[model samples]
Structures are given as C-alpha cells and as structure tokens.
Target: MKGASSEGRFVIDLPDSDAALALAGVGNQTLHSIEALTGASLVIRGLELVVAGLPTQLEKAVGVLELIRPLWQEGQIISSVDLQAAFKAFDKGYKEDHASLSDHILVRSKRGIHLRPKTIRQKAYIKAMETHDLTFGIGPAGTGKTFLAAVLAVRMLMERKVERLVLTRPAVEAGERLGFLPGDLQQKVDPYLRPLYDSFHTLLGMEKTNALLEKGVIEVAPLAYMRGRTLENSFVILDEAQNTTSAQMKMFLTRLGERSRMVVTGDITQIDLPGGVLSGLVEACDVLEKTDGIAISRLTAEDVVRHSIVQKVVDAYARKDS
Candidate 1:
C-alpha cells in the first residue's frame, strides 16, 4: 500500500491459475524493470504490483510490464503488435546501437515469437548478426543462443539478403549415449537439429518451408555433412556447434564461400566434447574474437529467453560455478 498508484490504473488478467503461480516465480523481475525504467520502487503481492512513480512514467511502465506478464512463468507466443508496443514502451532515447536486429526484424502482429532477451550482452548478439558475414553466438542453454540465430537467419533469407537458408548441428550425445538412437546418420542427427526445424516451421509456415526444403532452397543437415562443402550466397546456421571438435569447426567455417554469411551458435557451457578434446566453437570464438571481419557475440544467463524462472535457474548455476 506504500507505493500504490496515484494515477496510473490498469488491471492485468493472466491466462489461468498456472500462469499466476508462474508469475510469482518472476516477481522480482517486475521490480527490477520498474526501478530501471521509472526510477521508482515496485512491490508485488500475489499477482498485483504496486508501482509508484510519476504518472506518465508509471503508466508507461504499467503497459510494458503487462506485455511480458504472460511470459513471467513460461514462454508464450507474443504478438508483433505486443512486441512493437513493448519496444516503444521500453524505448530509452535513441535505441541502443547494440539492438540492430531487434530494430529490424518486425515480428508480425499477433504472431508470437518466443524470445525476450534483456541484457547488454543479448543486445550485442543481435547487433553482431546484423553487421557480420560470419558470426559465432556462444553462450549457455536457454540464453536464446540457437533460437535467435535461427530467427535472424530466417529474417535475412526472407529479405533476400541471402539466397537460401541452411541449418546444421552436431549430433554428439552428452551422457545418454547415442549408440541406440535408432535409424542411420540422418535419423541420429535429426533429433539434435529438431529445435532448428521447430523454429523455422513456426516462423516460415510448414507448407512453404516444406516446399523450400524440397527444392533445396532450405537445407538442414548434420555437422558432418557440412564437410567438403562450399556455401555461397546463403544464410547458413550451425547450431549445437559445441559438440563439434576443432577440426570440424574449422571445416565448417571454411565452407563459408563468397557472398555467404554464416551464424554458428552454441553454448560453451554445454559442450559435449570429450575431456581432452577442445570444442571447435570454443576455439573459433577465441580466434575470431581477435580477427577483424568475423563477429563474436556472447550471451549470458541474463539473456535467457525462456521463462523468467529459466533466467534465475541459469543464474543459480552460474553462481555455483563461481
């Protein structure tokens, strides 16, 4: 009651009971964003947050907070209108130079894309993709590592900046062991690349995507298949790059021919390579970070795009590691 609104008044209706409980998990997020945006305190009790600030700033904060309410507990499909509106509400002067991709890719109104990265590192990742021909988005799981890469790749392909799209991921098994994963090479690698397929399917629609795949306009393959290949005039994405050894990463990087751009995204935190083996993605990042043409983008737990709880989960583990 201390910080109860003076003028700003709005009620946020969550979807259901599950959403309400989920919202509780991220109660602090509202507080943090309000403090950052309005220079005021936010107190949340149950599903309601009492935000005290100047009326105009509080109203703006209220609207921006509502845009992400559905995402407090779990990832939801947020409409383009909602995303654009949120961007406007969250706008602070000239858009940060590090948010180029976010500024360019207009998510269709009412068509939800499950991504919400709220840190300088995450914004840098978007900026890198916009400026580079070959980029490595390296970070931890749930950090929007692969999904954001795929989304940018799709947007570039749609804009004709690239002639086609290709996605590939290493098929290495972590602990479960893939010895019994069924079928042959394609079957084995399919599971690892399924996330890429899911994102593409959601963004491009199934029929058109299938048609593109059939015509070889969109190709998804195992990391091994990328060997001895030269990709030109295409937007190629390599997911799960951490599973790849140094040699394989080198080969994949070399495959970037003229006029082609590639995005190799992986979480070094989840590399599945053997103890003595070095991950190519890990190595490439070190080397490329020193180079001129290539871009190296790093995302942190603060950029987790899943549920807000997912961000906390990542942060908890990071603290343990430290």
Candidate 2:
C-alpha cells in the first residue's frame, strides 16, 4: 500500500493556472502540507495536477483537498487557518461542515477582513453567547474567547439590541505589584485593560471607538469599578476572570441588571491568582453550570486559531503539567 501502482495515479484538471497556484500556495507549501497529511504526492504542472499514492491515500488526499476548495476556487490564498481548519473538518464531518464553519461571519472590519469562527467549537461558542443572557467561554490563550465576545457585543450595541457596551477585566498583576506603578489609579490599571481596548479598536475604527468612549457608549474599566452598580440594558464583558476572587466574581455577576447580556471569558489554565486563592471563574463554572439561561463553552487547544505553533505550545505545557 505504500508504493504507487499505475492504477494509483489520478490526475486532476485545475480550472486554470491561478487555481493551481492558489491551491498549491506560495512555493507549494500548502501542497507539501497536504502530502505530509495524506501521504500522497501532488505534482502540479501548468493546469494539471498529478496525485499519486496508494488508492486509499488518493481518496483521503482528494477528500481533504475538497474541504478547502471553496477558498482556492475563489482565488483567495489558503491560509494556515484554512488549512488547519480543513484538516479538522476532514477528521470530523467533511466538506459540508467546512463550508458551514467558513460561513459564520461575526463581523467584517473596515479592511474587508471577515471575522468568523475558525473552528466548530468557536461556532458553538458564538452561538451560545448569542442565545444566552449569560455565557462563559473558558479556554486557552489564542482561542479568540475575548475577541469573539467583543465582536458580538459591539454588533449588538450597533443594532440597538443593547444600550451600551461595558468591558471590564481584573487588574490583577501576574508577576509585578500593581501598586508599584507610578501613576493614578486609572493610569495604573489601563495597561491591564489594553488588550480589551485593542479588540474594540480593531472592531470599530479608531475614531469611532474613541468617539463612543467619550460618549460613554463604550466603557472600559477595572472590575473594581463595578462593585455597587447595576449595569442595565448593557452588554457587559468580564475578561480575565481567572484573576478574580470568589467575592469579586459574585459582585460582578450580581451587577448584571435587566435587559443585559454578559460574557465572561478567561483561561483557567493561566490563572494568575495568588496561591491559595480560588479563581472566581472556576467556582462560578461549578455553581452556574446548571443555572437557567446560562451557557458555558469550554474550548480546548483544538479551538485555537492562532498560528499553529501556539497550539503546539499549549499542548506541550499541558503535557508537562500533567
């Protein structure tokens, strides 16, 4: 089964030279990845491609290629996300599921880049947030937990589904003491909330985001500011919940007023809480998992859409920890 027979050779006629180039990627790296994945040889000449391998390998190679056909067929460069997601789709359902994953666009930036779910669990996570009043997305870094939540929250605000958008995160220091910083309270904590600010800047253009911030349509604050307030008719996102204590998380949850939606996202594995301190996010998952009208999505490394290396890094650390 390892050697190719004459019958094992299958030639595919590409639409044109552009299709061939797009499918093969720059320097044929994508083709090489496909070969590595399916144990088949893909040779593209002009507008023809020769796929040679065992019969089963040929079938698998062809099936895998079909999952990414929609992008290549449109002359779009197949990215690592596309290739990786295609491989995942191949292992799970097939071409139909791949199409569905690519079609669930959350928001398009001013650059025309479609912000969409890059994995099936991401799709489910987005769905959970949309359908539920309170949603929790617990996952590893680079899984788009907070980015996707910001996207939906902004979309809802624009559509008047929510009166305002409030983004808060625990300003807990990972290694350094927050009090040692040389500034007022806001200045000291702004660094901790920069990631949340960047997400909004990318979602809405810089000028609009600043204007909204000035008008209080968008508010970014440290979690400590929400202690005694009721956030009504707002979309509230509590990021970095892993740094919150049980008391802090309880206060934050109770602040969710009527006609509001809340999305809590954090990487429990990356908890920076002091030793002996329990993460509120961890405890809340146990407490509210069975509560009515709440949805919790736990995404693994499989859902990481960052550079493929990030997934490897996550898995490597996980192995060491285990």
- The numbered model that scores best in TM-score is 2
Overall lDDT per candidate, in order of appearance: 0.69, 0.87
Residue-level lDDT tens digits of model 2 in 1-322: 1333578887777787777888889889989988888899999878777888898789778877777765666555777877788877876765676678666767776555567787878899999999999999999999999999999998898789998999999978833677788888878888989999999989898899999999999999999899999999999999999999999999999999999999999999998888999999999999998999999999999988889999999999999999
lDDT of predicted model 1: 0.69
TM-score of each: 0.70, 0.85
Q: After TM-score superposition, what is the CA distance of residue 112 in candidate 1 from its true location, in Å?
A: 6.3
Best by lDDT: 2
Q: Which stretches of candidate 1 lie over 4 Å from their true place?
A: 1-103, 107-120, 174-184
Error of 2 at 215 (Å): 2.8
Model 1, 188-266: lDDT tens digits are 6677778887887877778877898899889998887988889999988988888889899889999998888888888
lDDT of 1 at 155: 71
Off by over 4 Å in 2: 1-32, 39-54, 73-77, 92-96, 174-176
RMSD of each: 7.6, 3.8
